[model samples]
Target: MSENRLTNILVPVFAVILGIIAGAIVMIVSGYDPIAGYSALLYGAFGDRYYIGETIRQVTPYILAGLAVAFAFRTGLFNIGVEGQLIVGWLAAVWVGVAFELPKVIHLPLAIIAAGAAGALWGFIPGFLKARFRVHEVIVTIMMNYIALYVSNAVIRSVLSDQGFKSEKIHPSASLRSEFLQSLTDYSTLHYGIIISLIAAVVMWFLLEKTTTGYELRAVGFNQHASHYAGMNVNRNIILAMVISGAFAGIAGAMEGLGTFENVSVKAGFTGVGFDGIAVALLGGNHAFGIILAAVLFGALKVGALEMPSAADVPTELVDIVIALIIFFVASSYLIRLVLTRFKKEGK
Candidate 1:
């Protein structure tokens, strides 16, 4: 058991090391100082309280998005609709946020929950189709993504357009601000969403590892046929998994709008956070704690990359390249496993 655990940890670590080595080689070939560039990257990400706060801000949504993908993955589903769900969720949340006037406590949570419901409804269509008509989830999810983007743009134009491509700002009551912390941090964007995200991670971990529903989901994932034979409802589980996944993704959108942007803008384009969640989930090996760690890493990279071009003369695009390389190495972990096995055999 210890060896298995060690192998699992080392696999990801090795992947990261190899990715860094490959990135360094690329930097050298491009006539950049790899060491200095990396030093700047590290400093930019962790050098100050301001940067760290920004990193946490960026990580907030990533946690939800990562959980969305990881949860679906656990149930043998590939929910490519997270992008669409997030978009719709953002639109719904901000629409309600601006349209309502209520007490802070009631307004904020209600708008957020509305976002989750909207996202779940969007995901439910694909789930229904798959469960009833045997439709391929991959194709349905991809189509839903485009539909969501275009539909959202049209809604924004029709409903919120004041000759611009943006919606009205959310009501102050609906906003999730931490005035005390903001004052201390000089108005940094960090908000109460971080606490919500942490709670979500813990809840998801418990649901997946400790609950009977989790066992059913995993059993269905491992063998749907066997699950059905054992009196489990396969179709119901599939739909439930997708709905739950979409709900998490919706919360991601809510976090972005309520906590960060304070409103949804069609011109902001898709946050692509759903896609980024794929990388986070994969890099974290789909574990809840690992997902949090991975989200922070990616968040740090994003925040740090902004400072790179100005401080270290390295392009922000290089950071993307590094991330891609890391993802590639992670996806091909068998290569590292083989190498490790060879080394062990030789040593023996």
Candidate 2:
């Protein structure tokens, strides 16, 4: 393998191993058996058909959310507001699903489109500001997340809600739920969302790797001044990158509204999906297939964590600590590379 490819593949793997070891140490310190905890975690994630179904369902959204972050990263923009875009997208999808009465084909596509559009618009603001006024996107996106939270809550209470706690459940025609898939998996919440996520991954891969637009976006990411000198519209590509990224995040929300929950409820806090996407993208090396694998790993950990408490008498929080450590290792991969180089030299 090429050195870059080898490094890319090995880094995340090493990080995962180190993270697991650190987690075991923590478990030992906390008077828990690491072996039993991990065994329970494995069983919880894939031991039963039901657990497998749930893990796949959980993985669906993570894939899109990770893609959203990864796409923007490739285009040299830090899209921290994927959380906001996802919120608005969820609200838009549920609104369309509840309000419209149409055939299944029309209704489902319409709701999904509304969600992507909503997220794109949400993403456009920061993109525009950054492109036009040189405002840092990170600051704007962070603030916008709060704006989205409060605004969506208000809209749900005043506009969409009947009882003021959550919006009405979406129509059947607009839903992504699949009875056949559920039956196959012992009736878990698994739906067509996984298909959508897969399709999105393909789309991202084709667009970024095959198209001239993708090349231009990547060039801008590499060096905007050089891209502008090379006759590329740097500003436009930045905006487009964020728009596409937001669309991916929005679809992630639709997976919840149309596939998982089929309704929109007032969230007490951020769903944490967007934040997790940052880690997913980082671990995946910002590649399409890599993100899918990373999402599945994270989804497995999350679903598996539930069983830790019941089966191993270990707190579920240990999984979170492990995840944090994995991210830490991934982020500090330079140190890992340094150690690897020293070891290789010693061996020589």
Top candidate by lDDT: 2
Off by over 4 Å in 2: 343-348
lDDT of 1 by residue, 1-348 (tens): 886777778888898888889988888898888888888888877787767777888999999899989988988889988989988888888988999999998999998999999889888888888888989888998899899998988888889667568899999999987787687566778888888888889988998899999889988888999999999999998898889888888888899889899977775466779899999889888888889988998888888888878877888899899999999999999998888878878999
| Local distance difference test, candidate 1 | 0.87
Q: In candidate 2, residue 329 scores what lDDT?
A: 99
lDDT tens digits, residue span 219-309, model 2? 9989999999999999999999999999999999888889999999888889999999999999999999999999999999999999999
Report, for all candidates in order, the number of backbone clashes: 0, 0
Q: Give each model a TM-score.
A: 0.96, 0.98
Q: Cα lDDT of all candidates, in order?
A: 0.87, 0.94
Measured over all alpha carbons after superposition, the RMSD of each candidate to the real structure, in angstroms, is 1.5, 1.1
